[model samples]
Target: MRRLLLFSGLVGALASCTTASESTTSTKPDRDPVAHSTIVECILYDGMTKTSPQLVTVTAGTEVQITDTVDYYFMKARVVKDGKTYSGYLQRQCFGK
Candidate 1:
């Protein structure tokens, strides 16, 4: 029957059209255990990143490790006082050149 043929054709067509999939996993490299690392001083930061709930402020000349520079204004750094790495945005230039 024509209906049976059409159904078979449709099934065949759908079977021929296979979907290929590719998987990828992204992992950030470790930039810690810095040796001879250049420390940066916090010049100005409005308590912390606006997104963070806890407001943390660092005084001038605070020792910090600039890990990943997200952009010209913000960078991922570790505050030496807390001993925990945090991603915070900096409002003013605070690092020593």
Candidate 2:
């Protein structure tokens, strides 16, 4: 009975360690060198191009984080609405300085 208890304890410890390691590894790291800005008024496209499907129509004063600049006209941006994060392309003119 003592050996069985010891074996069960060992298995429980191993399972806890595995769960901790998996949780750490599963976390997603944030993008590097990002700039926070506000949306003046724009639509977040699914792709860098305007022809891509429109994801959402962000209103003026909405907060956004600029991840990448596609060009003078378009930029890769991330938005948060209703506690959910949204990523897509936005026009440069729609961002405030």
TM-score of 1: 0.39
Best by lDDT: 2
In order, the Cα lDDT scores of the candidates are: 0.53, 0.82
Clashes of each: 0, 0
Query: What's the TM-score of each model vs. the native?
Result: 0.39, 0.58
lDDT at position 6, candidate 1 = 100
Q: Please, what are the lDDT tens digits per residue for candidate 1 over residues 10-85?
A: 9887766653223244465766633123234343232345454543566665656665566666656555446654
The residue pairs in collision within model 2 are none
True-vs-predicted CA distance for residue 64, candidate 1, Å = 0.6
Query: Which residue segments of model 2 deviate by more than 4 Å?
Result: 1-35
The root-mean-square deviation over C-alpha atoms between each candidate and the true structure, in angstroms, is 7.0, 8.4
